[model samples]
Every structure is written in structure tokens, then in C-alpha cells.
Target chain A: MSEFKQAEHKLLLIPGPIEFSDPVLLANATPGTAHTSPAFIPVFGESIKLLRKVLLSTEESGSQPILIAGSGTLGWDAVGVNLVERGDEVVVLNTGYFGDSFAECLEIYGAKVNQVKAEVGNIPTDDAIIQALASKPKIITITHVDTSTGVLSPAQHISSLVKKHSPETLIVLDAVCSVASEEIKFDEWGLDVIISATQKGLGVPPGLSVVLASKRAVEASENRKTPQQGYYISWKKWIPIMKNYEAGKPSYFATPPVQLIYALHTALESITAKPISERIDAHKAASKYVKDELTALGLDFVPKSRDIAANGMTAVRFPSGLKAPDVLPKLAERDIVVAAGLHKAIVTEYFRIGHMGVTAVDRQRGDLEKVINGIKEVLGKK
Target chain B: MSEFKQAEHKLLLIPGPIEFSDPVLLANATPGTAHTSPAFIPVFGESIKLLRKVLLSTEESGSQPILIAGSGTLGWDAVGVNLVERGDEVVVLNTGYFGDSFAECLEIYGAKVNQVKAEVGNIPTDDAIIQALASKPKIITITHVDTSTGVLSPAQHISSLVKKHSPETLIVLDAVCSVASEEIKFDEWGLDVIISATQKGLGVPPGLSVVLASKRAVEASENRKTPQQGYYISWKKWIPIMKNYEAGKPSYFATPPVQLIYALHTALESITAKPISERIDAHKAASKYVKDELTALGLDFVPKSRDIAANGMTAVRFPSGLKAPDVLPKLAERDIVVAAGLHKAIVTEYFRIGHMGVTAVDRQRGDLEKVINGIKEVLGKK
Candidate 1:
């Protein structure tokens, strides 16, 4: 119906919805298709299966239902709104900004939050978490990677602790930033609910959020999350539609974003084409290269230890006297965009460079080097 | 990262995501620019301005608040989640499917629903409505077009009636199928909230639902609707972001579908290129032609009067004992796809043809003729 135009910009090295390639971007401009079309159901059906496969789960053993929506963070509302009875006791693990945000969101929903916090860039110990669960947290919510502190909580380790101590507490891991960057292992990690997004490690544009739900999550949803259900986050209707649609009676609660799904379908194919090991390794390599360059620049790190830093992002403390406001605008003048820390505590102190969705080894290195040099120049260390 | 793939079908002409021209589809695929990029914010800003313009609202009197998410139906959720409080009275005029859906959805949000009934294909008179709203209602919800019945209600008339009878009640119109197909004056009609989506009149893909908010809608939203708010549907965070994103600070409640917006921006240009009046007239003329052809083929109009029929779609009733299912697959084999009647009473009695989007003019006319001739050929009608 119209001509699509491209904006003139150099690149986005920001965490999530990072610089997707031109061809990938063009995927969204495809002609809209009817969501219930015979051709669409299979493609959509296969996508949920592939998403499970990528998350290292299966329909039977994993039993985590998958739903595609417009935002990744919606997964939090889905989990918190469902499985959360009014005044349900939910233990929130305050690892960093996202964890706090999740707790605040749950509090809004009338959940009593018992926080088990760790130092901003450190992981909480299994014992510390077990002690917190003494209050009987109905839901144990944790972030896989906190965007602000660049901390990757050992979700697998925490899930193990919750299983042993609070056997009944449902576990929800916010994998919004980590799913594509590293191994989520939904089944292997015994994750009850895993929330992810297309933009982050998946390398697709922002819009679609993926939820991997266990049978427990669904069952819990039925008993705990009922009445006055928020329309935007209902997995109940979507589940039946997805089930019926694949079996041949396709329908929707609302109009499916056909073109974005086209792009996401393409993005999914790319992820599923290669083995998960290869994809994770590529992100690992990309992260290593960016970290090395920054280390060589003599900058301080935000995380207390390198092991705690997120694979998807490397957060480095800005030069002692320099703030992100000053450094970021200078970076922007050159058309290179990086992420400002989300937490008010470190928003002025640190900046993040994301390395997800890289097309080639060389391109990742090139973008990292450009960022490295820009940082150096800004700090007068070049 | 890998070769991109298009949707499986060779033809995607059902309805919604009608047919994105090549360049428009590709626009969404562009790399993730900083949402607050000097280059990007203006583009985002322009989209809001363009929407306000097309929806026929004054810029000063209106605020271009953008909320990015899935489907037009979410607009209803946004309005309810943000505006309709528990025990508040919401009047829903049910001319067709979405009107019923609006009533049902509002009821879910704890609103006391006053569902004003109308004949399946007839608009409820403004007088009937004003009498119905003798007691002040919190909101007046109506639909411009009923996609299920091919009926266009007198939406403007209802808005004026609400203004006269209950000035305090907000006027919320579901213009999902009528915004671009027909005229939807968001401001002039005193409509507080007008919801349309990408697929139908907008001439884009089916992923995003765009809603326009008048000053009153925003004012009403300031009142808390629910004890708990769904984050995805929360306008508190979204409205402020929309008002400020142009200043290079991008704060969105949910991760917006980036590519979808890009394609929409492109499609919007095409829709507004020709004056909207011409587009509206063309659809009206085309719909009349289809109706005439069906009448010539000895079929009755689904809606009693031509004036009641929607310009975007034409629903034609089949002869007695003629099932739509029997003729649909046969027509599909001949390369035309039409919608089956949604109401159970009309399921076997009627079928509908969509004439919106980039449907070739003669092909559309010929398609109607083919459907009519094909039905005649199949039923052994002389």
C-alpha cells in the first residue's frame, strides 16, 4: 500500500533490539497475511515448537506452553497476575534494577514481596535464598540478567535451591536479556516459567515476547489467577486458540501482527537453523571480544568480577569524572548508540555495549572496536 | 545473520495486513535505531502527528500519545484498564460482533455494563440511546463498522447523542474497520477515544492496533480504573512516554514492535496521499457495485438497507439451503478468498467479500461477479 523508507543511522549496539541487519529489517515490510490462513498456522505452529527447542524443552517433559506477544516484559505481568492470589506471598530476588522493577510490579498486584537481595553485581547464595523462602514465597521471581548491573544470576542454581527448600513455590526466571545470549535450559534448569523477548539475544526487532510456561504455570494460573483478568496478558485464550489453530481452526483474540510475525518467523528460522550450541558460542565470542577491548582501554568494570558480567552486555564504569549523559551524547554525535544504565544509582556512572545479533565475526569485532575507540576518545585515553 | 524467508502463501488477501507493498514491509526490517535517536524520534513523532491528522483532531487540543502493542482490541483493554473503574456504568451499543465484544470485555474489568441492543444490521437510533442513557453512564462505547455483519452504525450520531444526553460519559468508538475505509472524525464528533488498527483501513500488516485519544479520554484515564493494573495495558507509563519520546527520551511501557511501526509509517503515507474523502467514496462505490451484482444474481442484501451496509465489506445472503461452506472452497480454487458469515444464523446463509486495501478495481468487481455467477452455476439457478 505504501513505500517503506529507511532511516540514515550508523548502528545500534544497545542491549536488546540491537542492530538487526537490513534484510532482517525488510522482513517486517512483507505483505500482511490472514493469521488464520492455512499457510500461516503451520508456520506459527512450528515457531512455538522451535521456541521450545531453542529454550531446550519438549512438549511432554518440558510441558511449558509458549505464547507470542508484543512485549517481553509482559511475561512478568503474566506470571505475577496469574499464579498470584490476592495477598499471595511472593519472594522477589533483588539482584538489580529489573528484579526491583518486577517486585514493584508484583506489589501493585497485591502480592506481599519478601525480598532476598544481593549486592548489585553479585549473585545471591543458595543458603541466603533458602532462608528468605522460610516465609514461604508462593512465587520465587528472579532475573537471569539484570540490565543495569550487568549481573547474571545463576538461575539454575537458585531453582535448585527453591526446589529443595520451598518445594511448592513456583519459579519464574526473567530471561528477557539472557535467553539468546546463553543457555536457558528451561527443562534442564527446571524452570517453571521463562520469559524472553525477540529483541535481545534473539536478534529480532522489538515487538514480540515469548513465554515458556510449564504445566505447573498453567495449572497455577487456573487456580490462582482468576477474575478481572487483564485482557492484554491472558494466556488462557491464547492457549486454546494456539491449540485449536494448529489443529486447523485458526482464530485470534485480536488481529495478529502479520508482518512482524513474518520478520519473527525469519528470525526464528535463523535461530533454529544452527544448533543452539553454535549460537551461544557466537554470543560468547562476541562478548569476549568486547570485554577484551574494554579491558585494554583501562576502564573499570561495573560488576565486581568478570564471571558476574552478563554475556549479552558488558557494563563498564564511565571515567571517574564522566557521566553517561556527557559520554553518551558524544557517542551519539558519531551515530553509535549504546545503552545507558537503567538504574538511577549507576545511570550516570556506567554505559553498556551489547553484542547480540551479530551477522559475522568481523562485524561484531568492528562494532566493538568502534565503540572502544569512541570511549577511549571521550575519556582522552585514545 | 542468515537468509530471510517470506510468508509461505503466494497470495495473502483475506483481510487485515491486506498487502504491504515491498518497500513498506522492508521498512520494519531496518536495524534497531535508538528509539530516542534524533533521527528516530522525529520519525516516531511524525507518526503520532499523522495519526492525529487523519483521525481529524486538532494538535493543540490533542496529545499524540503512542502505545505500541498487539492488535486493535488491546485499545479496548487500554481504555478499560486505564479508565473504567469498578461499578462504573459503561453503555455498550451492540450493532454487531465487536460491540458485543466491547461490552463483554468491559464487564471483565468489573464495569457495570449497559448493553444497548440494536437489530443485527441496523444502527440504534440516537433517541433510543439517549433514553437508555437517562442515568449518566461513565462511557458510551459504539462501533463504526460491524465486520461480522457488513453494517456501519451511525457512530457520529451516537457520539452527538451522548454529548447531549450525558456529557460526562466518554464517547469511545471502535473504528477498527472504518477509520480509513470511511470517515472517523475523532475530535469533531467529541469522541474521547477512537480505536483502529493496521490491517483494514490503515493498509498495513495486522500486528499493531493504533488508538487515538482525545483530550477527554486522557482526562478520564487520570481516574484509577482498577485496584490492580496490568503493566502491558497500563497507560500511566505509556502516555507520558508518548508525550516525551520526541525530546529524545524514549520510555515505553512495553517493547514496541519496531518493524511494524516502520511499515505503518510507510503505509500511512500512501493512505493520506490521496485525500481520505476520495478513498472513502471509492470504497462506498465499490461496495455498492458488489451489492448490486449480488442482487442481480438473485441474492438478498444481508443488511436490510444499502445505507446500513459497510463500505469496506459487502455481505450477500445466499439462497435458502445454499451453504457458504459448499461454495467457498470452490471459489478458493478459482483464486478468490472471502470471509464466511460469523453469526450462526447467517453462517450458511451468507458470505462476505472485502474490498478494502489494494484490491485491483476490476478484479474486485469481477470477483463479485464470479462469486455470484459461480453460486448460480453451482445451484443450477437459471
Candidate 2:
């Protein structure tokens, strides 16, 4: 097949469902292929294997990747249902709205959650996390990049600290906004689980919830005293099916989204073709360029420290006396779409722009330049 | 815009992930749009409105439509979490594998389940159903068309019986393989819930799970004394978001699959533009044509009675001494894809063919003809 061209439309500068490459979108438009069709089976199998390469997990590490037909929030349910029994204790390292929601999701499965809450645009410190570990929680969840405030927590550092303090605790990372763009050394960091979505860093349309679990996490689930309560989200039912698929044999627990899987296969192929370090560097450079331009216009960031900010997206507080109506429309008028603030306390006080995937990595697209120009024009920066 | 054209490939005759129309496929290839963009809000709102027309749910009936980014199985979880609280009794009419799985899902949510298992390709008799209902179960789950065995349950007749004997019992229909091809009147039948997927009769690639619930179902969910235990599948979290989107306001609990929703909008518009009754009739005629051809080749169907078989798909036993390996590759050689058997008891004894969507409704495409020719050629019946 030759290169496929995508239809032209407005640039999506929002956090997720970002601009996809022509090949990825074309893959999504494939004619319906049976989930078990030979042509489609390997597409799914290869996709699963490629997920490991993206996360830097080796086959020998016994890290299993799960791709299910749901949004990013479903990943939380998968973690909650598979790992947490009634009254099990879990520690949540809060960064923003997603951290609060993740804790609430775990609570639904009857988990007793103890959150080390961070201020807006910040993450819990290592000291606080270590102190929480003293309480002896079963799992510790940290949001790698909180979409609400664009805060990038130190997942590697936190995972190391958890290992040092509590050897038995499972380290879970919410990487919905960080997977393909961020530098995640799954094995090197001693992380147990990473929950993500297709729309954000993977550069595909939203639908599939991606989860990667280490051998220890799977063992914990297998040894649980109680039966997992969720039929769809349970790892007990899915792990074997995932294993069978990766082995090039078809197994069915549920019907997968065949077209979306094809898209994911193509996206993973593109993502893993180059060194992951290059992708991370590209995202970092693009983020710096955009942040530097915003700063030149005298804008302030939600994250107080530049080191704590995410490389994939930016959350900037609107100038005093300016809100969404005044700023968002001006950008819309310029044919760029940005997101409204999601932090509960400052819902109307700021806005967000995403610069991941093709918009960030494919510099020739000039997406960030257009977004920067639109923001400058809207704010009368000239 | 002029009519969109899809790429040519093999005819997909599997039970789902069926052939899609040009408009629907084009919609799926849409450039990334923000989930909350003004342009997208109307698309989502109109999609919800069109779903009502497809289900024959009148506005006065207060039937609420929910479109979530997940597979059809998620619908079962939605019903279990939202309405069937712990210790609640639910009766399942088991026509095939899906009914067994649905019962298991309800059980996962702590529902006490009683199943009336039908013989393969058959449904429970009225007397048996009445006897089961005598226990006054809180809910009755029925698979409208069991994809495993292609058995079509008498939903209207069963709904009428439930209304006469147990007026308060909620009736949920699993219409994953039946929706557009089968005739269903949600209001007239008093169906509390109908669960479906985009890949089947809807003629779109799978990703989105489509559900419609009655006002009574909504009230049952709302009046629950205990908090819902699911975060992503909770109706409480989804209902308000659905309400806001339908009212042209953007609200999000989790990100919707924006491109898939756009595809659903196009498919619904196409389905609704023509009289729905006409679409059902077209599917019926196509089914008759395919079934007659199979019978001519001395093939027997899983469903003993023709009336009990689904119009959208067929499950036919392999001739004695012939199995999947013997038959599947022959059809594949002819560029046709069919599904392997799914019913545990008959996993290798039969195969399934889908005739819904463009394959059945748009006769000019000759999809069924190609499938018929391929099957005849494979069996050496020329």
C-alpha cells in the first residue's frame, strides 16, 4: 500500500484526539475485518508486542499489556477490579482531577483509599509518599501526567521510592497523557502497572484503554482471596486471551474493536520505528518552544515550576480580566481549538493546549507555530 | 460534499464488523475533532435523537439513549451496575453463549441470577418463562438475537407476557446482532433497556456501545438506595452527561470516541432516512435468499425453526466430515471472510455469516450474491 492522505480540517490542539498522521487515520478507515480473521489477528498480536517496546518492557520481564474497547477511565476500573478487594488499602498520589477520580474509582471496588493530596499543578513529594507507604497499602497509583493541570509527576522517582520503602507494594502509573510521548522505562523504574488511552500520546482516536501490568501485579491478582467482581475488566478473564492473541492464536472473551485495533497497530508501528528517546526529545523541544512563546506574552503557567510541567500539553492561566469567552473564541476564529480549564478551583481561570503526537513530533506540520501565533494574536501580544 | 467512496476489499460476512456504507466509513475517517467543540456537540446531539427513531422509542416515552466508547458487552455491565444492586434477583433467558455471559456479568455485580437455558438455537417456552417469572425477579435479561447460535428470541411476545404477569419487572434486550435488521418497538414492547454495538446492523466499525433505556429504567437507577459501585459504567455519571450533550451543551464524564460517534451519526441518519420498516424488510428478504441458497446446498441451520433464526446472520452446521479447516480456507481463497462458531458446545461444528448493513440492505452491492457463490464454489455444488 502507498501513503494515504487524510482529509483536511481544523488543527486539534486539545489534550487528546490530537492530530493523527495520515497513515494512522487511514488504518482506522479499514474495511471491516473479522476480529479473528488471519489478516487481522496478527495486526492485534503485533500491536500487543509493540506496546512492550514502547514502554521499554522486555518479553522476559513478564509484563503483560491489555488493550480493551473503552476510554481511558476504563483502565482505572481494570486496575481497581483486578487488584483491589473489599477494604483493601491503596495510596493515591494526587496531582489533579484525574487523581481524585482514580481514587474514587478504586473506592467503588470497596478500596479504602488514602490520598497524599498535592496542591493544584503539583504532585505529592517523595517524603509524603514514603510516609503513606508506612501505612502498608496494597497498591500506590500516581498520575504520570495529569491532563487537568499539565503536571508531570516524577513516576520513576516515585516508583523507586516505593520500592525502597515498601517492597511488596505495587506501583501503578496513570499514563493516559504520557505513554508514547513521555520517557517511561517500565522495567527500569520497577513500575507495576501503567494505564493509558489511545487518543492522547498514542495519536489515535479515543476508544481503547491500554494497560500494562508487571508479573508481580498479575501474581497479586491470581492470589487474591476473593473472586474479581468485574466481568469485563477482570484480568483473570483477559490475561489468557491476551496471551493467546500474542502467540498468534485467536481467543475470544469479548469482541474487540477490529478497526481501532488496526489503527493502534499502525500507530504503534510508527511509534516504535524510531528510538523512543527521539520521540521524548521531540516532545520536550516542542513543549519548551511553546512554553517559551507563551511566557514571552507574559502568560503564567498553572504549574509553578517548569520542571514539574508536562511536555505533551500546557495549562496556562488566562491573564487577569480575561476568561474563556474572550480568549477561546479568538483562537477558534483562527481555526485552532484549545481546551477549557478542568482544575476544580480554577475552572474558568485558565485554558490548555496540547502539543503531542504529530503536532509535536512532526515539526514540518507547523501545528505549534500556528497555535502560538493564534494565542499571540488573540492576546494582542504585538 | 459528494458521495464518499470506500476502498475495495474482501466482502466481510462475519456476524459483526460487517460491510459499512460509504458515508459511514467516511465519517469514521473524519479528522480529529475536540470532544467539546461546538461543531461536534450538534453531531452528538443529533446522533442521540436519531437513535430514538431507530429504536422506535417515542419522545413521550422518555427513553434515554446512551452512547459510550466501549464494546457491546459494556452494556451488560451498565445495566448490572446501574439497576441490579447487590442481592437483586435477575432471570436470564439463555438462547446461547451471550446469555450465559450476560448472566455471569450480572452475577459479578452481586445479582443473584437464575437462568432458563434453552437448547442450542432455541428459546424458552412461554410456560417456562411464566414459571420463572412467578418468583418475581427484579429484572429479565433476554438476548434478542444470540450471535453465537443465530437464535432470535421473541422479544415482543416475551415483553407482553412480562407486562401482564409482572408489570414491575425490567426487561433488558441484548440486541448486539439484531438492532437495524430486526423490528423492535422499545416503547410498545415496554423494553427497559436495549444494548447494541456499532459494528453489527448499524454498519459502522465497532468501538461504540449503543444503549437505550426507558424512563422507568432511569428511575430504577436513580431510586437505588446504595451507591453504584462502578465508576466508568455508572449510569449516574453518564446520564447527566448524556442529558447535557443532547441539550447541545458539552459535558463529559469520560472522553467519547469522537470519530466513532461521527460514524454513528452518519449511519443513523442513513438508517433513519429510509423507513426503518423498509430496512427490516430488506434484511428479511436478504436472509431468505441466503438461507434458501444454503438449504439448496443441503446445509442445515443451527436454529431448528426458520422463524426462530435471526434475519441478519446465519449459523449453519458444516457437512459431515467437513470443519473449519476444510471450509474456511476455501471461502477465504475466494476473498470472503466468515466467522468460526462461538457456542462452546458447537465451536467447530458450524460457521456464521453476517448479512446486515450494506451487505443486506443495499442489494445493488451484491455482497450476499458473492457470499453465496463463494460457499457454493467451496462445497463443489456447482
Candidate 3:
């Protein structure tokens, strides 16, 4: 759109650091702009407002968004350090590798973690979640879409169950892989917190950790009984900074990534220009096409059922005799890049393809088609 | 160099997020590149090696560099959680605001911090440091250049005193404001750790936290008595990831910031193209010119003397009957930007001007000349 063209490169069909738009990249190429400059203040403020719209949150909903310079994993630290005090009980609905890691992160901060782990290709059952809630854990974490196995947990249903069974327990959704591609109704779903990053569905580079906390979640962090165990990840230092920026004033706790923030501002402008539902619908349509094509190719999926599959990406088990080396290298030779399996349980049996952001919403790119055809050619099923 | 031109904006003369080169910005504009991709592995590996050269470290010196997606503040978390166990005795050589914040960060992780305080715009006395070393603290932290007051401590002299008085104490330097613009001999100066960020003298955007640790410092982190109090900031998870990238292998604990790494790679390539001392010398020359011009205008400096002042930036106190409101806005009117004071003790008495990276090294840009001329015009001294 800006008359700038990126150099030719392999199609990055992996989960994240997804293909960004030219305008977004151009914004990222911004010259030195002070974080507190008059020109950058509105950019930061507008980004905060746009994030609320993307999450289906509102001013009256009393939800606050925090943008920090870190990866999605740092979101785990933000939650672990800010909301959970030492010896507090936390329930983790484990779907795949991310669930185990999230639980591990919480445990590192001295949480007494209770995990409801599903099988390799499945989501935890409702019965297991309800059982875990009986203990009345202080917080319950759900990986909305785990990147490892492409397992999509039902966020709304889980939040409903938590509201009915343990209304006081804070609901934190790890939406790293699901945010823009999947339909999320934050306030309607009674969600308290959603942790995400820029590289996935946000259509920006990987440098920002975006988290939204409900009013109650903020109050909980403010009411912590002990001194914060970590400094950089503490909410106390960041809340004022966010409040100031959103108020169109310049403030600094730690330096914000100015260029990355510019990229995010441009990406968000494009994303929110149309109705967000339309974008989500486009992702849904793309997901179905890719899944249907893969199924027709006689491939099996990591998610046990189509309903539990992530719309942003898909994990397909290789044919019995084929492995990653047998298929991945061949695809690479064709200038297509996909990821090997990440779940430790089935690391060698499957591979993954991501269809999010421009890859999913911008059909003109034909990225999904390229991935499907590449897979077919590699498997000798063309 | 890449034929990419950034839009013109106000000259950023703040402490950091200084002016970046076009090539570095173009690199930041890179399209999607997977963190584990072979194409990205070498970029990351070379950035690590280049960081060593900038810091005067080497593989033979057993110094390892850790690059993470966070601000310079995150570096404190990495050191605090990894090296200081519960109730560990630590001494902070306080120069200004940064020293206080560093001590607070360490205390959050259960360190007992003893700060050797100095007056505003002054470094701690040798007697005070020697007396603090009598306690034989586990670590002694120094602020090489405190951005708040533009006070530069004598890093080599402090490390020498620590080595002579408390040989077991780990010497840490907070070089966030002085990594490339100032000389730091990591091995020869007996420094165990040097904490920095990308935006300062590295000429990249402010997203990546770069910290270099000597072998003994790495060992100290490895031998922590207590479990890590933080998860994302843990060295245990990051050491292997850094090592793998440096070894040209792909590994992941959390996703690295792919585009920022590309920018850092380009910036480091340029920074290490010549002897690092040349870059330091350029910063020195620029600093002297700015200081002399300000002095000719009858301005007082925040630093007590030129010998202890930082080469990357200068803090100048307002003459009687003048303040930031009287000068900063006028500079802004001329499209020249400088920062108001950050040190609380002199918040209304002074302002800061940065001369680092491209702004200091690329004289052809005439950035310094413009800043000097703008200041003279604003003060009606032209």
C-alpha cells in the first residue's frame, strides 16, 4: 500500500512472527521517535484503545490493557508475579506443552498448582475442570489455543463453568495463538485476563507482550499481601505508565519499543478498520478450507475433533511411515516453511501449519493454498 | 545503504532511543522470519559474538551474552533472581536514580541491599565503597552512567577495589547508558556482569535487553541455593537458548523477538566494523564539544567535573531564572527534542541531551550542530 516491496523469501507458515503487511513494516522502520514525544503519545494511546476493541472490551467494562516489551511468555510472568501470591492455589487446564509450561511458571512463583491435563490430542473434560474448581483455587488458567498441538479449548464455556462454580477465582486466558483469529467476547464471556503477543494474530513482529486485566484482577494485584517477588514484571510499576499513556500524557517506567509500537499502531488501524467479526469470520473460513483439504488428503489431526481445533493453525500427523525429515525438508526445498511438532508426547509424529493474520485474512496472498499444495506434493498425494 | 529512507522527524537528543541508521531501520522492517529458522540462527549468533567485541570480551574469556525481549530494567531481574538468593548481602554503589532502582529490584528478590549513597551529580567516595566492601557482600553493583543524573562512576576503579577487598564479590556494571559509547573492558576490568539494552549506544530500538556474564558469574547463577523466584527471567532457561543460538543450533524457551534481532544484527555489524575504540572516541569528541559549547553559554553541569561525566550524554542545569518550560518547548518548536530532568533532586533545574550512536558517530548528519544552534537560539544567546 505504501509502494514498498519486501524481498523474496520463504513463506513463513510457522505459528508466529507471521507475515506482516508492508505498511506495518514501514511503520516499524520509523526513525528515532521519543517514547514520550507528542507524535508518539497518541500512537500509544490509540493502541491501548484499539486493543480493547479487538478483545471486545469496553471502557465501562473496567478492563485494563498493558503493553510491555517482551514475548508472550512474559505474560505468564506478569500474571504469576502480580496476581498470585506465594502459596496461593492455582488451577491450570492443561491441553498441551503450553499448559505444562504455564503451570511450571506459576509454580516457580510459589503457587500450589493443580493441573487438569488432557490427552495428547484432546481438551480437558468439563468434569475434570469442575472437579478442579471444587478446591476454589485463587486463579484458573486456560490456554485458549495451545500452539503445541493446535488444541483449542472452549474459553467461553470454561469461563461459564468458573462463574457458576467458583465465581471468585480469576480467569486468565492464554490467547497467544487465538486472539485475532478466534472469536473472543471478553466481557460477555466473563473473562478476567487475556495474555497475548504481537507476532501471532496481531500481524506485527515479536517484541510486545499484550495483557488485559479486568477490574477485579487489577484490584487483586493491588491488594497483594506480600511484597512483589519480581520487579520488572510487577503491575505496580506498569499501571501508572499505562494510565498516563492512555490519558495522552507521556510517562516511562521502562522504555517502550517505539518502532514496534508504531508497527502495532499501523497493524491495529488496518485490523480495526473493518468490523472485527468480519476478520474473525475470514479466519474461520480459511481454517475450514485448510482443514478440509488436509482431511481429503487422508491426513490425521492432532486435535481429536474438529470442534477443538484452533482456527489459526493446524497440526497434522504424518503418514505412518513418514517423519519430519521426510516431509519438512521437501517443503523447504519448495520455498515453504512449516514447523515440526512441538508437543513432547508426539513430537516426531506430526507437523504444523499456521494460517493467521495476513496468511488467513488476506486471501490475495494465497498462503493457505500454497501450504496445502506444498504438503500434498511432499506427501506424494498430488 | 539499503535504499530505504525514513520519514523526517524531530531530532531525538534524549538519553537513548537515539538516532538509528537507515540500514538498521531497514533491518527492523524485515518480513516474517522464524526465530528457529536457519536464516535467523546465524543473525542471532553473530549478534552475540559482536556484543562480545563491543564489550571487549571473548570466548576465551568465558563471557556469555544473554539477549532477551525486554527493557534494560529486565536486566536487573535477570541478575536479581538468578544470583541473589534469599537474604543475600548486596552492596549498591549508588550514583543516582538508577542505583536506587537497582537496589530496590534486588531487594524484591530477597537481597539485603546496602547502598553507598552519593550527593546529587556526584559519584560515591572511595572511602565509602571500601567501608561497604568490609561486609564482603555477595555482589557489588555499579552504575556506569546513571541516566537520571548523567553521573558516570569509575567502573574499573570500583572493580579493582572489590577484587582487592572482597575477592569473592561479583562485580556488576549497569551500563545501560554507556555500552558502546563508553569504554568497557569486561575481562581486563574484572567485571563479572555488564547489563545493557539495545537502544542506548547499540543504535537499535528499545526492546532487547543485552547482558553479558563472565564464567564465574554464570557459575554463580547456576549454583543458586534457592529455586529461581522468577520463571521468564531465569538464567537456567535462557543460558541453553543463548548457547544454542551461539552454536548455530535452534532452541527455544520462549519466542525471541525476530525483527528486533535483525535490527540488532545490522547495528552490531556496523558498530563492530571498525575498532570499538573508534566509536568510543567519536562519542568522546562529541561529548567534549557539547560540554564546551554549553559552558561557553554560561551553563552549569549536573556532573561535578568533566572527568566523571558520561560520554554518551550531558546534563546541563539551567541558569538562574530559567527552567525546562522556558527552553524545551522552544527547542520543540524548532524540531529539536531534548529530555527534561529525570533526577528528582534536580527535576526542575536541568535537562539532558544525548549524543550517541548515529547522532554522535555520523557527523555528516549535523545533528549535534543543529541541537547546539537550536539551544543558543532558544536562550536568545545567538
Quick one: best DockQ, which candidate?
3
Q: What proportion of the true contacts does each candidate reproduce?
A: 0.74, 0.81, 0.86
Model 1 per-residue lDDT tens digits across residues B270-305 = 777777677777777767777777777778867779
Worst 10 residues of 2 chain A by lDDT: A1-10
Model number with the top lDDT: 3
lDDT per residue (tens digit) for residues A163-233 in model 3? 99999999999999988889999999989899999999999999999999999999999998987788997
Query: lDDT for every model?
Result: 0.73, 0.91, 0.93
Going through the candidates in the order shown, the clash numbers are 12, 0, 0
Docking class of 3: high
Candidate 1, residues A1-382: lDDT per residue as tens digits? 2233345567688876677654456666554566777667776776677788788888887365555546777777777656676688998888788887788778767789888888767888777898988877789988888877888787878888888888889899888888768768888877888888778877777777678888887778876535735666677667777666546677767766655566666777778888888888877777787788778877777878877778778888876677878888888877788888776666678888877766322363387778877877877787
DockQ per model, Cα: 0.52, 0.79, 0.87
Clashes by residue pair, model 3: none
| Ten contiguous residues with the weakest lDDT in model 2 chain B | B1-10
Per-candidate alpha-carbon RMSD to the true structure: 3.6, 1.2, 1.0
